[model samples]
Target: MTDDAPNSSTPPGLLPAGLMDLLPPEAEREAVLVETLMAAFAGHGYERVKPPLLEFEDSLLAGSGAAVAEQTFRLMDPVSQRMMGLRADTTPQVARIAATRLGLQPRPLRLCYAGQVLRVRGTQLAPERQLPQTGIELIGSDAPAADAEVALVAAAALAAAGVPSVSLDITLPTMAPALLEAAEVPPALRQRLARALDRKDAASVAALSGEAGPLAAALPVLLAAAGPADGALAALAGVELPPAARAIADNAAAVIAAIRARAPGLRITLDPVEFRGFRYHVGVAFTLYGPGTTGELARGGRYMSLNEEPATGMSLYPDAVLRAAPAPAPRPRVFVPAGTPEAALQALRAQGFATVAALSAADSPKGLRCSHRLVDGRAVPISKEG
Candidate 1:
């Protein structure tokens, strides 16, 4: 066949560049993973909540912190003059619910949701911006128990996702903030230090903090203290924690201690220099990653008393979790008719095989490499070399 360059004449369906179609097996695998995570959160008393994927820009930005706002996909509302946006993050929504609607219901609210978010940001890594996110937000309760519950739920979620050997990168959001404030670091200098600390670039951390004043003097030592959970906390002692920072540290330690005591074998690392990731992460922000990876598999943190109209919560990046998920075994194939999936399913059931609607006719047996197909518009028979 002669090579023909693609042009605009190609159907719009064929032009979906940053989008993907998940086949039955992949979709089923994702469904299973989401289900498993939901169960884990539910077990810990986090009730399920479904926040609207589409919201008025005002509502979405109601209490969303600064950094999170940068990630939203802004658009104009056709029905009204108001600008609108797809929620880039759901934690603020969760926070609003807890502070307003759920205020009368309970002092502490645990809610989780699975939703699709469209990121306008260029997907340099994956070339796909829209993805599913299943996350939980812990609101109302500032107690260490709440943090522990979140940690436990996160670990269980990873296990549910079939991730092997999850190593937690635990950090105290208050640490860096606390250090900057106590050291009386200049606003300009603190910014540079934050970046260096995130990259774990010791030279940069020193260089930036070195000129900030007395605050920069011991900054290197404190940052170097980052390691195992307990060790990091110990190193923090020399850092001079104000009451707020001390409280943040105490809460984190309690959460970590409980997780270790309960699970015993789970590995947790502490990075005290870790700054707040999402602008909403006020107290303790943490991320979980497996060995040999630089990106976070799952991340969340505490943001207590965010706004008067809302409260505390966390948002799990389901897309990240999905990315980190091990490829599951192929789902058992069930072929069905493209025209009449019902008739085909009825026939399949009669033949003793459970069946579902066929997603595409391209899977017909006679079609290109179509290993699975509905024979005679019904009946499911997985071929094998018997």
Candidate 2:
């Protein structure tokens, strides 16, 4: 081999940044993982639904979906000439489906979906603009038990995907906003408190809420209470919350109780101050993380469906789920020699071996990287002597 470096010119057809093509086994494994999650959701009574990748911009970005408006990719439809948007999230599309085609269906509709979504941007934690997501929506119920059901189903799906060491972080997106409203915190100070809480900065929270009264004073205390479920609940109990905020706390407690009943062994944490990544979540929300995974494995929360019915659901990122899954064993590949009879090769394949037939008469079963070779009328192991 020459010591000179190879040509480094840009290829004629390279993909855009933050987009990539999945190759071979990795792509196959991701497909398997998505199916596993869908099966898990189906087991919990969630029916699968498919929505088009693009839709009218107005409806797609309406209601709670407005939160993701900036992330949507917009275009002019060739037929309608109306502005259309490539979905950045599928939950809204599912909601639209529920409101229209499935509107006549009975209450408590359990729907699940698996598809690819395109976003205009990507965060540092998840650098891929295009992603595969699988999720379930529990629509038409506002009960706290609905929240717990969604959470439990999400955990079960992750477990089915071979990611068992997951930690679920539960939060109330409305907690800080409710507290600020209850405490009559001025608009300026509320913004400061929001920023500080988003960063989990206790000192700044305290500094901003110094003279805002006892309810406001609880801001720092709540910030400190972001940890294990038991401790966080105990800490929350001591904080004097206004009636609206107190109601939220009660709903969370109920959701926790229901989750404990369903999945007692799951690791759960509470972060009442975590307000990020839950733009449209109106109630209790959660994010799942594998033991050593950098970003969240999945996220879900309570929201309204079609701006009419109460709904709760969760969405899981296949890329992260696959990253956290156990490595799959290689498939058994059997290589057939060039002169091997077609009947013998068929026999090998019928026995569940992945047979690779030689293309030319000079081709032998050597160095093909297959696990076994067709010898005589049987697939036999390739010995060192061969």
Candidate 3:
């Protein structure tokens, strides 16, 4: 901040750093979505995994191929400058928990996490540094069936969250990476080209590739290769893709078929642009976008599903999701007194009430500010203006 800017000490009704103040209704809405999601996760026998928010850089990194390495926040440890970091993503930590920490526990470890991840994605993602991500990671299995199951689970989770008309835009990085390699592009130029391809701007892609000879030969086929599940698969029909590409395609097709079998009428698209980014995702990745928003509302894939280093998993920006979910009933909040006993509280919870037990107006106003959630009757819960 500039010296001309207001001093940090001059604050009430001010926020610090990247933290945000969510009102009761907003908080309650999130809780409702989470409730549905946790039930979905549990109904299918996926065990819950809660990793710590902080970890040593080694553990979170675990020698992986993620953009998280740069985004991780560093800190000096009181004992040693071992360089701790607030985790940028939880998959690597969950992978570690699966592979070594809980290896003896089970096969095909099904795990889900709901927590806030800190990162530095560019402004296109709104530069909102701290985001809440709730997702699943299935380890110890790379079955095509596993891939299908996860896609289904992802779709189901979005459905449970009250997100409708969800679209699964799928892709395989293997083929595009191979095709670019066959064209003998440089790393820097290839990055620029991939970006253009992501934007679906063939003119820019051709310019970046610098030779129409390759791009002209490649771009049309790539650009034309977009549509519904079966039709898009036809684009790749009988073409001999590289081995990695072929495997990726077959697996992706299986996933699409699985989704179709389970949930008909759900739209599925095949586009290489869907792979997310060059540095982050891998084979069989997808983002679930739909009617409410221009950008992706939810995304996940079978990234680092293997024993590879630098694990990959999906993350949902909760605020982004809140923006994407259709408007809900404005906050439903009630007040509860400070000294409510546990037994009474459980009874209220059994009826789907969220109890806010703070005493004073300052301490308890938050209870009433939330929608569809209530304060435990002790505190005066309504807005003063109301």
Candidate 4:
């Protein structure tokens, strides 16, 4: 082969779309961010749990898991000859554990988990197929207080991860459906209206015929009502909603009130007609955003766990969190000359120095990207010009 020709035997560094390696400081930073968030959850009495990366297709896709079925990757199991699936989300598995193995634990189970999730594809906003998730699940509670607690804890965890100015946008996923059901709109019109509302297309919604009765009129108002929490609540109160939709609004108000009482300074907003991306949330749900972040930093809401247990939780995307979080300060690395005492290395490590021992006299500390060098068993700063 000519020297200019491509080498057939050489492997390329190309990774599959929506997937890439996390190298150096970034990988370490993500690990630290996960631990920091987990510690915050633990502080709030959320014990840690680890779920398997794979499970039987039936069990993995049961109940709420059905929401992500399209994103799950499935394969036939060799031993059982049954279909198995890699987890696309950890929340369902956590719920499964709460309903089965830990069913008898307590009335309100608090659990936190951190792990990697593999999805078949990615969304327009989040185009990464492999992502790290750190989150907490508060199960067996239907109280609005449970919702508030989860939101607050998630905010606190994000704060601990060094994300500043985090804001919560609360949404009533069921309100629109409840309104439509009460108005008894035709199926075809209902689907169209729903699509319009999901897209937040006010012009399209207004263009729809007013023949749907109260629902047709109420939807545009609800869409307009989305704004800062206080004002939106006032607008919702003015709307003459059906009994079921009214109840949902009331529940949302209560949850928002609880959150405000606990975290008075938290930035809160409301969207009464947001029915997209929350497939299984039966009650109030919320999306968290950090200043300068592209997409949601975390999201959670009330849902029915396995065996129909009431549950609420939040899942933080570490990739997004790392983006919003302040850049981590690089750790000091110290180079130790050859034949350095093992005890000296241990001492440096005890002081939080990342020691890089020299393999030979020719190995330069600067070449190894070390910030310091060990001399007489002490870490001495290395000149940048060296």
Off by over 4 Å in 1: 1-11, 14-17, 242-244, 291-295, 305-314, 322-326, 334-386
Error of 3 at 25 (Å): 2.3
Residue 88 error for model 3, in Å?
1.3
Cα lDDT, model 3, residue 313: 46
| Highest-scoring model, TM-score | 4
| Per-residue alpha-carbon lDDT of candidate 1 for residues 1-386, written as tens digits (9 for 90 to 100) | 33685554666567456667778666777777888888878887889888777777776776553456777878787788788778777676676666666768766667888777766664576567677777787777776667666766777777876776677777776677776787788787888888888888999888887687665565687689888877887876666566766677777778788778777788888877677466656666767785565356667877754444323444555556666777764533455555664655666567555455555755544343333556666444456541
Clashes of 2: 0
C-alpha local distance difference test of each model? 0.69, 0.87, 0.66, 0.91
Instruction: Give the root-mean-square deviation of each candidate in angstroms.
Output: 5.2, 4.3, 5.6, 2.5
Worst 10 residues of 1 by lDDT: 362-371
Count of steric clashes across candidates, in order? 0, 0, 16, 0
Residues 318-377 of candidate 2: C-alpha lDDT, one tens digit per residue: 998887888788666788766677777677778778888888776566756777776666
Residue 208 of model 2: what lDDT? 88
TM of each candidate vs. truth: 0.80, 0.92, 0.78, 0.95
Worst 10 residues of 4 by lDDT: 207-216
Better of 2 and 4 by TM-score: 4
Segments in model 4 whose C-alpha atoms lie over 4 Å from true places: 1-12
Encode model 3's per-residue lDDT on 1-386: one tens digit a residue. 78798775756877545667777668877777766676777777777889988877776776442457888887877887687888877666778787777868656778888887887454554656777777777776666666666667776776767676678787776667766666677787777767777778877865665562452344445556777767778766645555555566677777777777777888888874344543556667767785755577666666563256323345554566666676675533444566667776676666655665666657644434543224443323355555
**Which rank order by lDDT, best down to worst?**
4, 2, 1, 3
- In the predicted model 4, the residue pairs found to clash are none
Runs in model 2 lying further than 4 Å from the true structure = 1-10, 337-351, 362-369, 383-386
The CA lDDT at 319 in model 1 is: 58
